[model samples]
Target: MLEVLNNDWKRLLEEKMYLCVSIALTICSIVAAIVLTNTMQTKGNIAMVVTDQSANTSLSKKFSSSPYFHVSKMKKAPLESDMVQNRYDAIVTMKEDGSYNIKTIKSDDMKKMIVGALNNPDSYVPSNDKDREIGTNIMGYMMMFVLIQGLFYARFFAKDKEEHIIKRVVTSPIAFRKYLFGHATFILGMIFAPTFAVILIAKILGVAIGFSLLTYALLIAVLSILATAFALFLNSFFCVADTANMIGTATITLTTILAGSFYSFTKKESVLDKLVHLLPQKDFINYVNALEKGHLSRNIELQFIYVLVISAIFFLIAVMKTKRDYVYR
Candidate 1:
C-alpha cells in the first residue's frame, strides 16, 4: 500500500492534476463567494414601499425595525408594475383595519420571511449571520468542486486499465486491494487539497466560515472520502479514460443540479424534494446550514453516519467491481 501510494503520488505530480484543479477551483470559489454575497444582500433585504401613513405608526415602525426589510414611506400609490420590474422587492399597503397587503416578486422563502416580520416585528431579529452565509456559499461551491474533480481523478483508474498497468500490478506481489486502496487514498488527498485551499483563501479574503476549524476539517475529510468513493464507483463502469470522463462528467452535472447545489427548490411537492434525500450533496449543504444555526451536535452525528454509510457502500461496490474486472483478469 505504501509503495502504491508513493507511485500514485508520483503519477499525480507528473500529471499536475491537483495543482491545476486546486488553483482553478480556488479562484472559482472566491468569485462565487463574492457573487453570492452581493446576490444574497439583494434577495435577503426585502425593500418595502409603504403608501399609507395613517394606518399605524407603531406597525410601520415595527416593519422598519425588522432586519429583513428596508421600509420607506411612499408619497404616491404603490404600483405592481414597478414591483414586477423588481424596482421594489415588495409593496405593503395599509388597510383601514391596520392590516397589511403584500405584493412581491420574491420566492416562497423570501415571501415567508416578509410575512413573518410583519406578524411580529418586535420579536423579529434580522439575521446578521455572516459566518453562516459565507459558510454555505463556500460549502456549496466546494461540494460542486469536489464532484467535478472526482470526475477528472477517476480518469487515473481508466487510464491505468487502458495502459495495462492494472494487468502488470496483478502479476506482481502487491495485493490488488492494497492497490485500489492506495488509489482511493490518493483521490481523497487530491480532493481535500482544494477544500483546504478554499478555506484558507476564504479566511484570507475575510469571509467568515461560521464553524470552528476542527469542525470544518472533519466535514471536509468526510466529504472528500465520499467524493473519492463516488468517483471510484463511477469509474468502475468504464475501462476507457475518455468514456469515463464523458459519462461521469455528465452524470455528476445533472445530479448536482437536481440535488440543489446551485438553485434551491422551494416548493414542497416538487420532484426534487423526493429525489434530494438520495443525494449526498443535499445532506452536505443541509449540514452546513445546520452548523450555521449552532445545531451541530445532532447534525454532526447524522451527517457523519449518513456520509460514512454511503461512502462505505459505494467503496465496497467499487472494490467488488475491481475484483471482478481487474483482479480475476
Candidate 2:
C-alpha cells in the first residue's frame, strides 16, 4: 500500500492540472461565500415598536448603541416580508410594564440575545454563532467542488484498471484489498490537504469562518473520506475515467442541489423529501445548521455516524465489485 501510495503521488506530477484546478475552485468558492454573506445586511437589524412610548425610546436608544444589535423604532409591527428580505432581523414590542414580545423569521436563539440585550445595555457578545453563518456558507459552496475533485482523483484508480496495472499487483505480494485501500488513502490525503488549507488560512486571517480550526478539519476530513469512497465506488463500476466522470458530475450536481447545498431545503410529506433525506449531503448540512444553534448534542454525533456509514457502504461495494471482477475472475 505504501508503494502504491508513493507511485500514485509520482503519477500526480503528470496530472497537476486537475489538482491545481481543484484547489483554485475550492478557494474561489470560499471567497464567493464570504462576499455573498457580507453583502446581505444581517444580524443587528431590529425594528422596535414598543407599545409603551417611554420604554420604546429608552430601550431603542439603549440596545441600538450596543454593537451586536441595531434597534430602529417602528410606527407599527414590521412586516413578515421585511423579515424575509432580511431588512429586519427581529421586531421587539414592549408592553407598558416593560416586558416585551419579540417576533422574527429566525429561530428563538436570537430572541435570547435580544432579551439579554434589553436587560443589559452592555450585553453585546455573540451568544452563539453569528446570526449569519459565514462558515456554513463556505462549506455549503464547497460540497460540489470537493465531490467532483474526488471523482477526478479517483481517476487514477480507473487508469490502473484500464492499463492493467492491477494485474501485476494481483499476482504480487500485495493483496487486492491493500491496493484498493492504498488508492483510497491517496485520494483522501490529496483532497484533505487543500481543503484543510482553506480553513487554516481563514483562521489565520481572523475571518469568522464559522467554527474552530479543529472542527473544520474534522468536518472536512469526514467529507473528504466520503468523497473518496464515492469516487472509488463510481470508478469500480466504470473503469474509464471519462465515463465515470460524466456520470458523476451529472449525479453530483443534481443530488447536491436537491440536497440544498446552497439554499434551504424544504421538507414535505412526499417521496421526494424521503429521497432527499437519504442523501448524505442533506443530513450533513442539517447537522451543521443544528450545531450553530447549540441544539446539537455533541455526544450523539449521530449525523457524522450516518455519513461515515454511507462512506463505508460505498467503499465496501467498490471493493466487493472489484474483487469479483478482477481478482476472482
Candidate 3:
C-alpha cells in the first residue's frame, strides 16, 4: 500500500496537468478572497442623512467615532429618486413630529451596514457570519472539486485498459486491491497537499483559521475518500470515461449548488432549504457557524456523521462492485 501510494504521488508530481490545475485553483481562491474582503470593507462605509435633530446628533457622533462607519450628512431632505441617482447608501428623513424615516438607496454593502447599525443588532444580523464560515465552506467546495477531478481520473482507467496496461499490471505481483488503492492514494495526495499549503498561507495572513484544525482535516479527508470511492464506483460501472465524467460532473455540481456553495439557501424558508438539509455542505457550514459562535449543536454533528456514513456506504458499494474484476480493463 505504501509503495503504491508513493508511486502514485510520484506520478502525479510528474504530471503537468495536475500542476496547472492546482495553480489555477489557487489563483481563483485568492481572487475570491480579495473580492469578498473588498466588498465587506466597502459595505462598512455608508452615507446617511439625519432626520431627528437629537438622533442625528447621536448618530453623527457614533458614525464618526466608529471605524466601520463612514458618515455623510446632508442638510436638506433628498427625494428618493435623487438619493438613488446620487448613489447615497441611505437617506434619513427627520419628521416635524420627531419621527425618523430611513430609506436605502441601494443594496450594496454600505446599505447593509447602515441598516445593521440602525436596526437592533439582535434583530438584524449580517451575512458576515457567512464570511467567517467561508474557510470551512471553501474547504468543502474544494473537496467537491477533488471529487470531480477523481471522476475525471476514472477515464484514465479505461485508457489504461485500451493500452493493455491493466493486463500488464494484473500479470505482475500487484494485487488488484493494491492497484486501486494505489490510484486512490495518488488522487488524494494530488487533491490535498496544495490545498493544505493554501490553508497555511491563509493562516499566516491572519485569516481566522477555524477552532479545530483536526476536525476540519478529518472532514476533508472523509470527503476526499468519498470522492475516491465514487471514482472507483464509476470505473466499475462504466466502460467509457466520458460517461463517468459527464455523470460525475453533473452530480457533483448539482450537489454543491444545492448545498449553497454560491448563495446560502438557509436564509430562504423555501423548499430548497428543506431539500438542501439532506446534503453535507449546508450542514457543514451550519456546524462551522455554530462553532464560530462558541455553540455546537447535536443536530449539526449528527448531520456530519450522517454524511460520513453515506460516504462509507459508497465506499463499500464500490469495493463490492469492483472486487470481481482484478484487471482494470
Highest-lDDT candidate: 2
Ranking, lDDT, top scorer first? 2, 1, 3
TM-scores vs. true structure, each candidate: 0.73, 0.72, 0.65
Best by TM-score: 1
lDDT of each: 0.71, 0.81, 0.60
Which digits, one per residue and each the tens of the lDDT, describe model 2 over residues 1-329?
A: 99889988988988899889999989998998898887754346888885546455565667767676667866688788998776887888766666678887554567777888888866556654434377778888898899888988888899998888877889999988788999999999989999899779888998778888888888898889989999999999986889999999899999998887886424355567777888898878767766655667763368658888999999999999999888898
Which residue window of length 10 is worst by lDDT in model 3?
37-46
Total residue pair clashes for candidate 3: 3
Candidate 3 per-residue lDDT, tens place, 1-329, comes to 66666655555557668567754665465447445644554333344555446444544555445545555666665566765444555675544444456666343454456656555333444456435455554554565565676774555564554556766777878887787777777666665555566666766787665545566566557666666767777666766667777887898888877676654424355566788887765666566556666667788778768767766776677666656554443
Worst window of 10 by summed lDDT in candidate 2:
123-132
Segments of candidate 3 deviating more than 4 angstroms: 10-14, 34-38, 41-134, 140-143, 152-158, 161-164, 167-172, 205-216, 266-269, 325-329
Off by over 4 Å in 2: 42-132, 268-271, 297-300
Instruction: Give the lDDT of residue 283 in candidate 2.
Output: 79
